[model samples]
Target: MFRDTSHLVVEELSRTLERIDPAQVQAFVDALLAADKVFVVGVGRVLLALQAMTKRFAHLGIAITYVGAITEPAITPKDLLVVGSGSGSSLFPLAIARKAKAIGAKVVHIGSNPQSDMKDVADFMVRIPVRTKLYLDDEIDSRQPMTSLFEQSLLIFGDIVAKMIIDERQLDLKGLWQHHANLE
Candidate 1:
C-alpha cells in the first residue's frame, strides 16, 4: 500500500511537471529580474512557498518583501507582486492584486487555473497544471489529499526559479553567503 501511494504521488507530480509552460516561467523570471521591488503573497502552504522564495530572492540581492510584513513599504508602480494561489479566486489575494494594480504595480500570478479571477488583473501569469480545488473533478485528480499536489508543486517551482535566477546572474555560493544575515 505504501509503495502504491508513492508511485501514485510520483505519477501525479510527473504529469504536472510535463504540463508546465517554460515560456511562462521565463516570462515570470524576466519580470522579476526587471522589477525594482518584488512582493509575494499567498495563503496557507502556498504562503510558505512564497516566503521561501522571498528568502532566496533576498539572498540573491533582489529587493523583496512579504506582502503582510511590517517591513513591507507601500507597493508602488515600480514594484511587482508575485501571487501563488491554487484556486486563484481567493478573496484576499484578489483584493490585494486589485490594489496593487490600482497603484500601478505589475502582477504575476502562478496558479493551477489559467482562468482564475486574479489572472484577469495579472500582467503576467503561469498556470501550473495540477489538481487544484478549482478543478477537483478533472480527469487528473490528485492521489494525495486536497491541494497537496498544487502546494508541493508551488514549493518546487520556487526552488527552480531561484536556481534559474542564480544561474542567470552568475551568482555563486560566496556571493549568496555575503547576503546572509550575520547579525543573527
Candidate 2:
C-alpha cells in the first residue's frame, strides 16, 4: 500500500538541479535579459514548456515567442532563440541552432548533452539530464506511452529563472497580474 514512485523522482530531480552550475545559470539569465527579443522552441511536450516561459516573460513586458507562433519567423539576428532540446539529439533543433548561429543570432540550448552538435553552435547551454521510461514514443508519441520529464524540467526551470528575475526587479503580484489573461 505504500507504493507510488514520487520520492524517487523528486530525489532525482533534486540531484539534477544540484548539478546545474550556479555561475553559468546567472550568466545565462543576464544574457537572456539583455537580448532584444526572445524566441523559444521545442518539439512535442517541450513546446508546452516554451509556452510556460512565454507567459512569464509576457508578464514582464519582454518580447518572447515560441517558434511555432505567427511572429516567430520575424526573429532576426539581433534576437535570442532559446531551444529546449532536452536530448540535444534532435536533428531539427540542432539544424536550427546552426542556422541561427550563421545568421548572427544568439542560441541557447537547454538540454542534457553539453558535447552535442547543438551545443557546439549554441551561445549558451544549460544541461538538465532526464531519464525517460521509454524513448521512441517521445518523438512520434506512439501508444507505447510517453512522459515529459524533460518538458516538466524545462517548465520548472524556466519558472525558476522567471522567479529570480521577478525578485531581482522587485516585481509584485500586482505587477504580474497586469500581464494576466483578462479574457480568461
Candidate 3:
C-alpha cells in the first residue's frame, strides 16, 4: 500500500510539473540570475518549501533569504522577490509583494492562480496550476489531502530552477560544495 501511494503521489506530481510552461520557467531563471539578491516569502507549508529553495540557491552562491529573517537585508530595485502562495491570495505574501513592487524590486509570483490579486502586483508569474484552496477550474486535481500536491510540486520546482541555473552558468558541481554550510 505504501508503495502504491508513493507511486500515485509521484505520478500526480509528474503531471503537475509537466503542465508548467518552459518559457515561464526560463523567465524565472532569468530573473533569479539577474537579481543582485533574491528574497522569498510564503506562509505555512509553502514557506517550508521556499525555505528549502533558499538553502539550495545559497549553495549555488546566490544571495538569498527568507523575507522575515532577522538577518534579511533591505530589498532594493536590484533585488528580486519570489513569493510562493498556492492561491496567490495569502495576506502576508500579497502585502509583501506589493511592498516589494513599490520599492522598485522585481516580483515573481509562483502560484496556481493566474487571476489572483497578485497578478496586478507581480512583474510576472510562474504558474504551478495545481489544486489550490481556491479550487480554480484549471487546477489539476489531486488524490492527496489539502494543498499537498501544490506544496510538494513547489519544492520540486525550486530544485528544477536551481538545476537550470547550474547548467546555464556551466557551474562545476564540485565547486558548489564550497558554498554549502560548513558550521553544521
Candidate 4:
C-alpha cells in the first residue's frame, strides 16, 4: 500500500507539472504586480502554502495579507484574492472568492479542479492536476486521507508564483532582501 501510494503521488505530481500553463502563471504574476494589495487564503494543508507566500510576499513591494489564525479581511477594487483549494468546491473558499468579487476585487484560484465553484469567480485560475478528496478514504485530518497532493502542491506552487512575481516585477535580490525583517 505504501509503495502504491508513493507511485500515485509521483504520477500526480508529474501530471500537475505537465498541465500547468506558463501563460496562466504569467497572467497571475502580472495581476499580483498590478494590484495595490494581495490576500492569500486556504484551508488545512493548503493554508501552510499561503502562510509561506505571505511571508515572502510581504518582502516585496506590494502588501500581502493572509488567512491564518484569524480570517483576514481584504475587499477593494485594487485588492487581489489568491485562494488555494484542491477541491475547488469548498464552501468557505468559494464564498470568500465571491465576496471579493462583490467588492470589485480580482480573484485568483489555485486548485486541482478547473470546473470548481470558485473557477467561475476567478479572474485567473492556475489548475494543478491532482485527484480530489473523493479518491481517498476518510482520515482524521485529510478533508480525506490518502490524497494530500493538493496540499503538497500548494506549498510548491506558492513558491513558484513568488518567483514569477519577482521576475515580472524586475525586483532584484537586494530590493526584496530590504523588506526582510531586521528584528528577526
How much does candidate 4 score in TM-score?
0.80
Please give, for residues 1-184, the per-residue lDDT of candidate 4 as tens digits. Answer: 8898788767766666666788887888888888888888787678877788788878776788874446565468988999888778878888888988999999999876776688789987987666676443321122225547667766777677778777767779776778888996
Report the C-alpha lDDT of model 2 over 25-110, residue by residue, as the tens digit: 78668867888888887777887888888888888877888776766657678888888776676877777777777888898888
Candidate 3 lDDT for residue 94:
99
Q: Answer with 2 or 3, whichever has the higher TM-score.
A: 3
**TM-score per candidate:** 0.92, 0.85, 0.99, 0.80
lDDT for each residue of candidate 3 in 1-184, tens digit (9 for 90 to 100): 9999999999999999999999999999999999999999999999999999999999998999999899999999999999999899999999999999999999999999999999999999999999988898999999999999999999999999999999999999999999988899
Per-residue CA lDDT of model 1 for 1-184, tens digit only, reads 9999989988887888778889999999999999999999988889998898888889888899988998998888999999889888988888899999999999999987777788679997887877777664542578689889888888788888889998898888676899888999
TM-score of 1: 0.92
Q: Which candidate number maximizes lDDT?
A: 3
Question: What ranges in model 3 sit over 4 Å off?
Answer: none
* Residue 164 lDDT in candidate 2: 84
Deviation in Å, model 4, residue 128 alpha carbon: 0.7
> Looking at model 3, which ten-residue stretch has the lowest summed lDDT?
130-139
Where in model 4 is the C-alpha error above 4 Å?
1-15, 68-74, 135-145
